[model samples]
Target: MGTWDSLHKQHVDVFIRINLLEKALLGLLQNRATGDMKGAASLQKDFLKAFEQGMILHFAVEEEALFPVLARAGEKPRILISELLAEHKSIMEKHNMIVQTAAVDKDKILLELIRELADHAKKEEQSIPSIISQLTPEQLNNIDQDAKRLGYRL
Candidate 1:
């Protein structure tokens, strides 16, 4: 697959994963409210695992494949890449907070994180692929290779 295609597929995967996470977070909230501590903890474990593997790795792959190229692009693209990078950092911080927080506090933070991610995804879907489309074929091939090397199977 070409760079844009691989990245697009990954974006779709992340979106689906986000939807699943929303469901899991909602379940966690319901569990906590009903005094089902065991259930809540179990769901928390699952959510954490998925978030780390799915979202964190997705961010890593994007950084590896796109950031350097975007950095070399024109002024507007450079600025936009910085914003995306900042969002990734913010999301990671929130993920860390969710890990350390109490159950009662966790759901609220998770909800915020989910909403932030949903918005972030929308931003990327609007911008990144078009920037990527401007790359040469060789550059596109290299990006796909880099993403695969980083363990993002297309």
Candidate 2:
């Protein structure tokens, strides 16, 4: 099978992660803090922990497996990948801050991170298919193989 065919599963995994994060964000937004600061903080902490774990794996699969191949394809793909990498960096920094900051600061940063991540995912979903369509089956296979080696799972 070609790389895009294999990549569908990985994309599904990423979409799932994004959906979960979005759901978590929705929950946090719906939650009313009736002076239960500890409870609010607890929810934020749980969201952060889950987001960090999933994003680490998500970014790894893209950065290590997919980006390099796309970058080499041409200037457009390279530029796009560069932007995505920058977003990844920013997301990580925000994620780290959320973990370390006080409860008062956590919610703002967490919301920002999730919004940024959702935008990033949208860009990937919109752009990557066209870029990958230009690649050879061998190139696609390489990305698929690399992702598998890095423990990408559906």
List CA RMSD, all candidates. 3.2, 3.9
Candidate 1, residue 37: the lDDT equals: 57
Which candidate number would show the highest TM-score if scored against the true structure? Answer: 1
Over 4 Å off, model 2: 1-46
Q: Over the stretch 51-119, how does candidate 1's per-residue lDDT look in tens digits?
A: 777667678878988677876778989999899999998888888887876656777787788778878
Q: What is residue 13's positional error in candidate 1, in angstroms?
A: 3.5
lDDT at 122, model 2: 77
- CA lDDT, every model vs. true structure: 0.76, 0.75
lDDT of 1: 0.76
Give one digit per residue, the lDDT tens place, for model 2 in 56-133.
877888899989999998998999999999999999999878767676756667778877877887788889999988
Model 2 reaches what TM-score against the true structure?
0.74
